[model samples]
Target: MNDINREFVSHDEALARAEAGVAKLAATRNDRWYPKFHIASNGGWINDPNGLCYYRGRWHVYYQLHPYSTQWGSCHWGHVSSDDMITWKREPIAFAPSLEADRDGVFSGSAVTGDDGRLWVFYTGHRWANGVDDADDNLEVQCAAVSDDGVHFEKLGVIIDNPKGFRHFRDPKVWKQDGMWYMVFGMSTADARGEVLLYSSENMRIWHFEQVLFRHPNPGVYMLECPDFFPVTDKDGNEKWVIGFSAMGSKPSGFMNRNANNAGYMIGTWEPGGQFTPETEFRLWDCGHNFYAPQSFNTVAGDTDDNTDGRQIMYGWYSPFVQPIPLDDEGWCGQLTLPREVFLGEDGDIHTVPAAEMAGLREDSTDLGVVEVKSGTETVVAENAEAMEIEMTIDLKNTTADRAGIKVHATPDGSYTYVAYDDQIGGIVLDRQANAFGDRGYRVAPLTADELAADQLTLRIYVDRGSVEVYVNDGHQTMSSYSYAADGPRAVKLVAESGDLTVASLTLHNLKSIGLE
Candidate 1:
């Protein structure tokens, strides 16, 4: 194999080497835990998604790329495109750390379409001058690149420098509002309180700093990364703003309180003066074991006040734990979650459902209708399916069980991960403690009062080799997690803790691999 990093005079040379490396690995490597449908690095390493946008009737996703190895190092931008967000086409390395300004690495950012129909990318250029080990040595500046066509790009140099007195600053998320360009970057105060700084640009090149959009009030949070903001209707039929950020340090309170490395959003209203008025408290975006650094984009028509347009979509890095995977043997690690449609629920919460086009990947489906399980477990569909989609409705009102839901990824010995609705807490829990093949943890995300008031609950679950993503009540809530196990006759069962539990309807689809072959 060629040295991952050799001489690079131009972007083409770097791309050719990366392409060669991935092709070599694909020819001889097979990891059972490699996902069948998710987007992963072509060869080396990928982290937070950089730029995501719609161009010429397709969706393009750019991610933090280190083409040398599966371990973190200097960064570049890896490109992939999809017509329907299900099957992705890997493009060449779009942005690399070639320019003097970004010689160290090209970090995370966002993408947008210019008024003249050109595609624009905004990213942070990172360099460590004083020392690599000290956080005080970090230096990052916002930069821009332009592309006449979606595949090729030309660097435009540094656009914004680090403001005075800030220790770390990066991850520029740019969007257009009322015909003006607004940019938000993750930042922190000198005292180590995390916040987002706002800026406005009349032209794409020059930007003027505004004010701190919002800050984490908790003293335990040191800093926040990958901040994203957008407007959506709240549950009360009122338009509101949603801001999301990834936090580091001890777990904060109010939303999903368990995970120490927490990622969530706050529902609020934005004034024309650029200040945000939080309407409701902060909440967890996804209560999954491995979800972070989420970025969302609009793929179709714009969203209305009621969020009826159904075009807002999002994707998050599968995990930030940086644990070793079987695929490390092939010189790659990390993946992005499936694209989900985001909308404001009627209960003042942000909700996400699988993109509509995912249905196209369902090859053979079975309709298991109205099964009753009393104080036991029953296999409803396939004995076990690694890549499958299950949609079922549980009659919570009529059921007498204290707790009920489905058991998935079950081994023959009854060791399996459980996804169930806890009647006592009136929330959902995903237990992966027994499945230590990958990361082991339990995640619980609560449902709103309106969600639990219903007589029936609906669940849509997508399970691939190492991931389990569940959508509750048509995406009013969602939990996404990752796990691994050996391939065999795993059990897919309807579980009831006590008393009769009735399944109103169940449908299981053995999903076909999307571009995995």
Candidate 2:
């Protein structure tokens, strides 16, 4: 069910192959966080973040690649790696469905490094035999594979295929703590309530089923995709290990199902012997239009010398609904948001920020001192500003404008990265039309209801060599985009059409990471 990409395939053949890869369904148009090597196309489906672990001096990311059609098929775990999280190198197929139970496709899974320093993958076994199926039993059961070198993996065969009750349970996150291996997976009951289950093992195999960590109330009945459990400690002495789940329910959006296959978090204290707060009440990590399938790296970030003294950093596939922009003409679709450091806030709430290492990616910085924009005003960035950082405010109360926004990371071809508050359009729009990241074309993410009515909007737009992230009103809403405009005349612009809004302050600084400091 797999074929090698001929090194010397003709242009037409390569185009066809690329298009064939395009046929594979893609979902969760990831925020503009991915580096250049990662690419995806129009909607179909995308499951877990694959090959997600630090191995042998580098970080690896494998995704359920359905390169033939956007519709979920024989999912081959596509591979890519990076040393600094900046420059990435795409490798060959990491894992293809080579078993009967998982024949329909490799499905989605997480990558883990065992105590032996070998990378072990704990994924679901779906499809009957022929890599395709449509039955209750054909869906999911856990299976695993091992890899010494991140690229080549040896399927250890069925590790544990759907043990005991519950018709559907999949997407396992494995980790070793206190001398025992543990796996947390998303599950569903016969009544359709979504649940997160726990399993433990002395070694990598022979596991005992634990209790359901948490489950959905009702509307989110179908199934939860990826489940992660880890500790989140902030600057103070507060420590809370969080258990999270994501639902991909067939239910529509409403009080019942705000996000189809949505992602949420729950804070709890870990009990003895691989058990957790089983009666935990789940809450949201963020109330945004997109955010789902969040996974954590096993590597303890910050001063790796003491793994015990690190924070649980997270990376989620921000799943945005397809609207306001078309994906076909763009050629590529979704991109992941930058890795983030997740921790507990002093208020006992969760807090997240772009990974500290990403700050090193800043290039040039600029500051425009207190440029005021009434209700309806537009402005362009000055020259010599390729990469930039901006702090601007729009006065929504002063004027009756339908929309107002600031644009940066612009190209001479008229394509630019924009972060605007559009009352007429509703929501904050991170428009990257002409400069579609990875040729995926323009993407517009509307702000949540509360976001649109913030009264005033504060925007921070960061432009790297090929990526841009827009954070509004102190992380109220964030839309990240990935694109390569190394040659484009990068600048910033502001547009406040239909309103007499005034700007509080507009400061741009050259990227500190690019020696412009």
Measured over all alpha carbons after superposition, the RMSD of each candidate to the real structure, in angstroms, is 4.2, 7.5
244-318 in candidate 1: lDDT tens per residue? Answer: 888876464544655657677888889657588777766767888778888987653222233234477898887
* Model 2 residue 146 distance off true place after TM-score fit, in angstroms: 1.7
Residue 230 error for model 2, in Å? Answer: 1.2
What TM-score would you give candidate 1 relative to the actual structure? 0.91
lDDT of each: 0.77, 0.60
Candidate 2 backbone overlaps, count: 42
Q: Among these predicted structures, which one has the highest TM-score? A: 1
Local error of candidate 2 at 223, Å?
1.0
C-alpha lDDT (0 to 100) for residue 445 of candidate 1 = 70
> Candidate 2: which stretches are off by over 4 Å?
1-47, 128-137, 164-167, 234-236, 250-258, 273-283, 286-290, 301-309, 318-325, 328-331, 382-404, 407-458, 462-469, 472-492, 495-517
Q: For each candidate, how many residue pairs have backbone atoms clashing (under 3 Å)?
A: 2, 42
TM-score of each: 0.91, 0.73
Candidate 2, TM-score vs. the true structure? 0.73
Off by over 4 Å in 1: 1-9, 24-28, 131-136, 234-237, 250-255, 300-310, 320-330
Give me the candidate number with maximum lDDT. Answer: 1
